[model samples]
Target: MVVLATKCYVEGDARSRALDGMGSMLDDDLGELSVEWTVGVRDDDFVSVTVEGEDATVARNLLRERWGEIPTDGRLTAGETYTGTLESWDDEGFVLDAGTRVRVPTSELGLGPGSPSQIRDRFGLVQHLPLRFVAGDADEPARLADAERDRLYEWSRGAGRVNVNSATRGEVRATVNRAGHAGDIVTVERLGLLEQSIVCAEGTDPPGLLASIGGYLPAELKCVIP
Candidate 1:
């Protein structure tokens, strides 16, 4: 399953209200699945968001197609999509694609309204951590740490910096925690945050390690990756 986080901005009172109403438009297009809605007020402006299911690609496509139809107080602006990969799963629901990360919604898939867990699981996240930054030195430990922390999973000799096509924020976070490093150092990569990478970590055994950390981190300490 894929999770997508999309935001939009609009102008005008009527348009703002219309934009708020537009959150439900996806339900009409994607059927009656559970969605979580949040509205934010910034001075005279308003921002509204609808978090749907774990299928980010589908949700992104739907939002891209329907954003214009929403009415708003001001001009409507579409926000970027934050995509998460599936990491693990059980009888409840699937974890995010990033790694041992679990996302248990209130409603079941293809069912009613959904609820998101406040804590994100960290399994399978280590391999996805960035190994280098685009402009930073390749050998410096700080630079290397930044790269790894930023979700750059793959690096080419001549291409400078390349993102790990399969890496996800969740996976990298879990991996960092498992390595006994500060997981908070890992952050979402700007470019691939919305798309999945084709590159994957070299090993297969690490996934189990990530899952174990996911179960342990939430209880051991405030393992937050900000």
Candidate 2:
């Protein structure tokens, strides 16, 4: 059994679809391997897969390659690098979920000059967006990876869309309808079970669209503008 670094927080029919999708993804990742697996969600939205079959070992390795491995032991060792989903943030730092909770201090965020929330918006970092971080020495805080920084830099320069979390794809679409901004989005990209990226239509401003629907969904929403 490997606890996946990703999450699945959607509910109802959306949740059913997400699980079925996850199963298909795992099957594709394993290719021709003869494997039987079950997808399960643990507390706080942790997704795990238990595989059994002739090619289980190879299948497990493939899973690790696609989605960073979850530490079954539940601890991030000093100096090790790992990927996790952003859970929440405070004045001090952001907390990530990787089987166990890991904290990424503001100083370790690598984003500059703002409150944690401000920094998140500046970079369009949405909850459940996978990010890599390295654990620090005894006195230092865990720091964000250069790769994560690069990804954020790219998002900042390339488009106009809001990245959001804690809402299923279906829920996002419904909210957009209620907000009367159905035409503003070109598409919705699923980042995780409950995290999604709204690709804005060519002339639509992502921030403006976010403002239109932000109040309806109680979740973190950040924008990417071209």
Candidate 3:
């Protein structure tokens, strides 16, 4: 069994569509392998896969490489590294869906001194971005990983881009293409189970691109400026 690090946080028909899409993606990912697998969606924003057959181990590793290993409860001891889908945030802190919800308080955000919202905006950290954090113990709150910090800083240095949340990679790509600005993006970087970062083409402003394509996607879109 392997728990994948993506979230399906929509509801009703949207929820069904998201689940079906995720199941299809898993099948496609493992289609060529000699393994039989079934996927289950967890309430806590994870996709669990149970694989059988002689090639199960290989399938497990392949899935692990594609989606970072889900941090099991036993691994949450203080100072251990884990990956999670960024859930939501407020003045207090940000919540990560690490199979279970893990809170990273404002003080432990590691993105410098500011309100959580301001820090997120300043750094372009969108919802559902796969964030790495160290598990905390007792009264301590989990803190963002140094590498994750470095990565956000790198994005801040690059050309500005448009970020989208609550949609899968394919959905975001299709929306972008339908917006008639297909030539305006460099690439669509998958940030989580549903979040995507559309890197802008040269001389393309993120805000303009967002304005152009925002109407087509049923997702929260934000502009990240360098």
- Predictions ranked by lDDT, top down? 2, 3, 1
1 or 3: which has the higher lDDT?
Answer: 3
| Residue 204 of model 2, lDDT score | 89
Local distance difference test, per candidate?
A: 0.31, 0.82, 0.81
Q: What is the TM-score of each candidate against the true structure?
A: 0.20, 0.82, 0.87
lDDT of 1 by residue, 1-226 (tens): 1122222222455345434444344456555444443434333222334454555456545654433111333221222122223333445543432111224232322222232222122212222221111111223211112323333223221122112222233444545556553422323343222112222233322333334444533221211211
Best by TM-score: 3
| Residue 72 of model 1, lDDT score | 37
Q: Which portions of model 1 show Cα errors greater than 4 Å?
A: 1-175, 178-200, 217-226
Backbone atom clashes (below 3 Å) for every candidate: 39, 2, 0
Better of 1 and 3 by TM-score: 3
1-119: candidate 3 lDDT, tens digit per residue: 88887767777887777777767877888788888988777767577889998889988998887777786653577887888877889899899877777889998887888898888
The number of residue pairs in model 1 that clash at the backbone is 39
What's the CA RMSD of model 2 in angstroms?
3.0
